[model samples]
Target: MTNVYLTARFPRIAFTKLETNGFTVDYYTGRDLISHSKLLRKVAKADFLITTLSTVVDSEIIDAAPNLKLIANFGAGFNNIDTEYAKSKGILVTNTPKVSTNSVCELTIGLMLALSHREVEGDQMMRKDGFPGWSPLYFLGHEIAGKELGIVGLGNIGSELAVKANALGMKASYFKPHQLSEDEEKAQNVTYKPFDELVKTSDFISINAPLTDENHHQFNAEVFDNMKDSAFLINVGRGPIVDEAALLKALKANKIAGAALDVYENEPVFDKKFTKLKNVILTPHIGNATVEARDAMAEIVADNVIWSSKGKEPKYVVNK
Candidate 1:
């Protein structure tokens, strides 16, 4: 029988799909991450391995799975899996792309609004200090309308964000290595700006790029220094894209007005100082945590595994 091993407990929809197709599925059900030794043991017997973004499938894990046919990642991002190495060993690697685009884009917009309007701080104040009476000058947060939103990636989520931002009365600009053509830009209602210019001018700068060898620590100390003093930073992308230490310094020094983040440089572990800052709002990487998005991703993962089982090439294969 074809066997599937999941590194973590995901939605039961995937297990149902796999079992209904006559595949035996097993997964780690612990709240914490699966231990490396247990992962090696389970993967050694798996024909198809389903991994989440938090599970690291390095060369050692790949090598241990002598019968491994596919690594179907449950998330849109596949940085946790070593695609090149998997391909070299004749193991197919796939990710559920576009499944989380709208969810993450919406979260990005939410973070932007929450940070700019001081929603988190206000909520805390209401709970701790009680209502100080409604006054025009009570919160004094900035409005997002008529503001410029600069996105640092023009992929699916970024493009979606641009469209949403324009609808919300915010002018959206983007910076990517490959600028979109004039027609494409017109279609999306976004203007292309150089990275430096976007950072220096926009009221809110969002990081929506994937993590790559060239883009680790893409936003560092210098980038923070270049941003407007009143600008806000929002990151719904991979955590390592920004230098967390530098961000801590900038927030403390008031280099920028504030920041809202869904990811951190070292995930599951971040600077405790950020928790104390009223200007910063942090989430536990819940960009795609919506029920609809997670269910869709689960279906995608099961579909990819089913395709591989039937000797068919999956549509979402990432490594050729």
Candidate 2:
């Protein structure tokens, strides 16, 4: 019988589909990450592997899985897997894309609302010290409506955000390498702005791009300097896209108003210094953590595994 190994315990749908199709499915059940030795042992006898973004499927791991025919990633981003090496070895790599689009887009807006309205700060204040009284100016915050929103990288999430922002009475503009046609921009109700221009003119800046060699550390001290003193930064994309040190400096100097981050430069680890500032809002990378998104992602992964089990092409091949 064919064997399938899951690096972590995901939703049971994946296991059900594999097993229903006569494949033996086994997974790690630890709360913490599985040890490398344990992972090696698990994959060595596997015919297929399911991975999360947190698990690094590097060259060594790939080499150990001599019979591995497929590496199905649970998340939209597959940067954790060595795609080139897998392709070289004729191993198929797949990702569940667009499954988390709505969840992530909603979280992006949630982060924006939390940051702009100082919701987190207010909550902390209420818990630590009882609200003195509702004074007119005690918790003053600017409304998001009528504000200029500059989105970086007009991908699926970014496009959705533009529509939502427009509905909320905010003006949305975006910066991407390839500019959309005038007609396309009108349909999306977003204007195209150059990167420097968008950063300088917008009241809020959001990062929705992927992690790539050309744009790593794209937002640094200089970019922060160019932003308005009252502007706020929101990052729902990869963490390294913005320089954490530079962001800390900018916050300390009041170069910009504040920032909200769902991702960190390093996974499962972040700068504790950010906790000291009331202006900063941090989330534990829960952009796609909603139940609906996870279920959808699991179904997609299971579908791909089923297809590959029948010696057919999977629906979402990333390395193809």
Candidate 3:
């Protein structure tokens, strides 16, 4: 049997499926993230190493696992793994992509609306005390109708947000690394915009861009300065894409109206000052947190592991 070391616990069904498919699985079952030292030690014996976004599978871990054939990631984004290094070592790395589209896109919309409508504040108010009757003067927020929503990327999640924005009666514009064909833009009800103009003119800006070398810290102080004071920023994409320091400075200066984030520059470590801000909404990287998405992710991880163990090319190979 192939020996698999799952660095973290995943859905139970997927675990069973992996074992049934001819692998013996060892795992770290704590609720917390596995430490780097522990990971290096545990992965030494695995033929396949299954990891979550929170785990960093660097060259060190890959080199440590002499028999490692594949790294099966439990989420759509595999930034946590060192793909280039894995490829150099002839280890396959795979992720679940399409399965997360709806769950992540839905959360993107939820974040946009939640930030725009002050949903978090409303929830806090309710939690703090009794039910206060509605007042005409209470909780004034931006209306969703007729707003210009600028999307930073037009990937699966971004495209879906654009489609949903259309139904909400909002205008959609996007800036992608590569321009979509005219038909794709039309299908998504999206118009292509230059990054500068999109940031300056949007009523709400949603980031669905992937993180890459060329676009790191794509949103900085100058970009924030160009934005309308009433504009709200929403990021459900990779966190480092936006310069967190610049974001904090902008927030402090009220350069933009508000912002929402599901990811952070530092995984699991965010500035506490963000917690005090009434204008911002932060989610715990829950873009793919839905039960449906999690289960599907687990299944994909299992499939990839099984195929790799059988010496077959796995689906969802990122290095390809």
Best by TM-score: 1
Off by over 4 Å in 1: none
**Residue 234, candidate 3: alpha-carbon lDDT:** 88
Model 2: lDDT of residue 46: 89
Model 1 lDDT, residue 156, Cα: 88
Error of 3 at 230 (Å): 0.8
Superposed by TM-score, candidate 3 places the C-alpha of residue 80 at a distance from the truth, in angstroms, of: 1.8
Candidate order by TM-score, highest to lowest? 1, 2, 3
How close to the true structure is residue 227 of candidate 2, measured as C-alpha lDDT?
99
Clash totals for all candidate models: 0, 0, 0
Tens digits of per-residue lDDT for model 2, 98-168 = 87888888988888888889999999998999687978878898899999999998988899999989999
Clashing pairs in 2: none
Question: Candidate 1 vs candidate 3: which has greater TM-score?
Answer: 1
Determine the backbone clash count of candidate 3: 0
Q: TM-score of predicted model 2? A: 0.98
The sequence of per-residue lDDT tens digits that candidate 3 reaches over residues 114-232 is: 88888998888888884568899877787888999999988778888888889999999999878889998887789999999888889999888878888899999999999999999
Using lDDT as the measure, the top candidate is 1
